[model samples]
Target: MTPFRTLTAEQIASLEALGNTAEDWSQVRVSEDFQPFQLQQSRLEGEVRIGSEARIIHSRVRNCQIGEGSLIEDVTALECRHRSSFGNGVGVATMNECGGRTVRIFDTMSAQMAYVMALYRHRPQTLAALERMIDRRVEERQSEIGRVGRNCRIVGARFLREVCIGDEVRIDGASLLENATLCDGVEIGVDVKACDLIAAEGARIGNGSTVERCFVGESCILDKGFTAAESLFFANSHCENGEAASIFAGPYTVSHHKSSLLIAGMFSFFNAGSGSNQSNHLFKSGAVHQSVHLRGCKFASGAYIMSPALEGAFTMVMGHHSYHHDTSALPYSYLIEKEGRSHLMPGANLASYGAVRDIEKWPARDHRKLKRDVIDFDEYNPYVTQAMLDAVNILHTLQEQDPDAEVYTYNKTLIRAASLQRGLKLYNKAIVAALGSMLDRGESNPRHNGAGRWIDAAGQYITRQAMREILDAVDRGELTDPTAVDNRFRIFDVHYDDYAHSWALQVYASLLGHTPTVGELNDAIQAGRNAHAALREMTDADRRRDCSLDMAVGYGLDCDNEEDRRRDYFAVRGLK
Candidate 1:
């Protein structure tokens, strides 16, 4: 594959001038401008190939293919013993680790996929089919040699084995890396030790971090001595100074504290505070307990959760709790500990401007350098809103089942009658807010698109009917692989709102026991507009208060009196 050629006497003379030696000159293939003097004390062994401009590769280069203009310096060894697909078809032993459920990882694997794999074990044949596809992909790339791409730099990296380095990657002071695939623009910094990793473009791991059998998605960073094992992190994830095991981090999930232990959980768009922790083992025999802390959940400092718990999206945990609660129906609530029991405060985050600010900041914080691998976008998009609608519908069913139940307890989480009523109101408002968001963004009619059951195709929000048609084609062998599925998933992030509106209106109409006509859609649009106007007014008022003189009291310098300080603050504030 390298366009190998035997070394002639003149070519040998040219190589010798560079002061490098190959165990078998015939196995070493170089371009026309090959210079042996450029390589010093480097042993090229077992079919090593160097491009035209690469120089000073390593102490030992075994079965490696170096691309043009790459620089490798101060590395102890680079070896590839066997052909590996990096993280393709990587089956991570989660939960018990005695091998109950193995989450298979692929390059295009999304956090949604990992979540389904961990929780939806009832669909065995489907998971097996997905795993088989990944296996086929791994077998397709049957090559033993490692690779260093063009314009890449490896400095002070002590050991690398069976790794496929993409173009323009930077590995500096990394101790060891094995069976990894690094995409373009990736950087592995000081004392990083990784095994079985797939780092997409703009992914960075540094500051004494250690990763084992992890899928570090595009633009994800694990720094400041973070330790992770068997974790799957998607685009724009960040973790530092903590430990994560058997975790699934979706886009924009961040935990930046030393004592954070995010283990055996599924998370996305989430944040963990300092000393936040969770146990996969509920004092069980074999650490078999698992949990689902869904997207946009946050934790206060020193907070602890005992799993097998399921806390819903945007829920905030504020204290230590050993109760295995399922607050999946109570999104954007606070789960606190009162008298060693779980106390639920519903819709509390709705009052916090911080939650709104977090949603605003996620889309703006995308750091992915590779556009191809970035799957999730618009962190608080309509996809999440659809999920909330689904949750609200489930709550409705529960209420219908027990008309007079006082304190409804489902899955260890207690919900008072007042809280349930308030939650339904809040959930309705949230949906209205979502619909209003769609309407304000020029969607005058909600029934314009996505007019069917929306199916979650591993993170791709698509119409279920269309997915059924695609899967039917796959069954017929008309589509050999899942190309159609991937193409449908490859749609841009902009369409999420349109699709969500169509689906939300349908769901809203269903709750009312009727199909939504154009008039209903228009009415929903009007409601949405009203909600938007109110939100704008509230946010503007809040911003005004934030810039007021009360907030600027300590910063006004050279002010002789309170009035002068207030005037100076107003001058800087430029408040109307």
Candidate 2:
């Protein structure tokens, strides 16, 4: 369908002086170098195709199809249709009266800002059945010239009636956008405001970010006054300032300070310090509640949490706690707060050295480049040292079931009876330093038949009756189905697979009861590897006596001696 070029009684008096009113001007069509005074008073319908250095200024369209060097500035297109390899080298700038009515096609160039956020949040009966499918592509572009490709751009967008954009994307100075799908090279900064979103590709919506019903993946980064609702962020997540409701931010999730607030939680590589917050609901009934921290966790600066807690994996929390503490069996512990209470310090971080420098800086702060659809999170395993050896065998069976009870009253806080006998001698010297580093790495690596294979306390492997059938499948609930607890912690995270290290080698062979001999499993793996290398050399001599510079001495009361106050604090703090 290519043969229509009529519109020239001086372009019908320059389109009735720039306010086009066409009931029929031979179904207005232009190309063959169309130029009725560069056209004006726009109002065209069906069988309309304008190309050859295309330009349709002062707009009001219906039943559309215009390609070839495309540009429809000051726009308003209704009942749209155009699907040829789709609306080429596109560009639309609307705002000249009836600033709303859908049907836009900016074919392939990396999803135009995800179509201005899904064509400005559609619904006018789905914007009149997508403008009757762009008036059946203006009667098949009346004769041809539809294929505009070469660096497209849509600017000063407003009340985008119903969006669906893609290709070499870049929507500048956007103020209002409805619905959404800005995939490919998406970059919508400057006064950005999106609704019902779905931004993928190199996602970046900085300058005053505001998205609703969100779902941003790929290279994510929602900057500044970031506000999100019904959220879901994956990929390299980075949410600035703060405010996320119904949150689920997986992939390297990072929340830049500024009174941070992440609601209805579920995060990943998560780091929310400055005024970190959370607390879904506590109305006793209504707003329900929620909270779960699994991945390489950390929350310091004015940290606060409240929502039926479950924290674990590489755990480390600071102050504020509104009761509800369920350290999901205490993985890599440290949940502080002195006077006000809550202090369960098992293996006091197995002689600290800052929890072995946060387990040697989480595999060098893995900033995952790609390859991540989901399931694959191992922030140091043995399922958090077997929930810190079942909170040190439930604090040694609640200190042998209350040896004259009152060692800081249980589950309400305050645990000093010299921290419950130095947390039961630092949880039996961290379960004999995790059974002597699992019998010195299973008698220096001797798998089976030699009847000499053991491992567990964290060295890893499986036996002792496949860890007592995973604590009898978590006591018959078979890991309470969430896809059988994510496939029983993905078969206890497969590496050296023995039925994925036999669910913590059957909970350390049911905390060592039946079958234990190869010299009582090499003397409980050399007493948990010499009490985890003597609690990491007594937490590196208590962090070198809590970072001693002669412990400061009240910041050296205006220097004098002590080498002129250590050379006036290394000349105003130079050398450490």
> Model 1, range 122-233, lDDT digits (tens) per residue?
7565556656666777776548888899999998889898888989999999999987888888999999999878887789999899999888888889999999998878
Q: What's the residue-level lDDT of 298 in candidate 2?
A: 74
RMSD over all Cα atoms, model 1 = 4.2
Please tell me which predicted candidate would have the highest lDDT against the true structure: 1
Checking candidate 1 for backbone clashes, the offending pairs are 18-36, 18-37, 19-36, 19-37, 436-528
| Candidate 1 ranges with C-alpha deviation above 4 Å | 1-4, 11-18, 94-96, 107-120, 369-411, 414-425, 439-479, 482-484, 491-498, 511-520, 536-576
Q: Write one digit per residue (lDDT tens) for candidate 2, span 375-475.
A: 33332234445566677677667777776666544454445555566656776666555544433442222232112222221112334343444435534
Q: After superposition, how far is residue 6 of candidate 1 from its true place, in Å?
A: 3.3
| Candidate 1 displacement at residue 304 in angstroms | 1.2
True lDDT of residue 140, candidate 2 = 40
Best by TM-score: 1
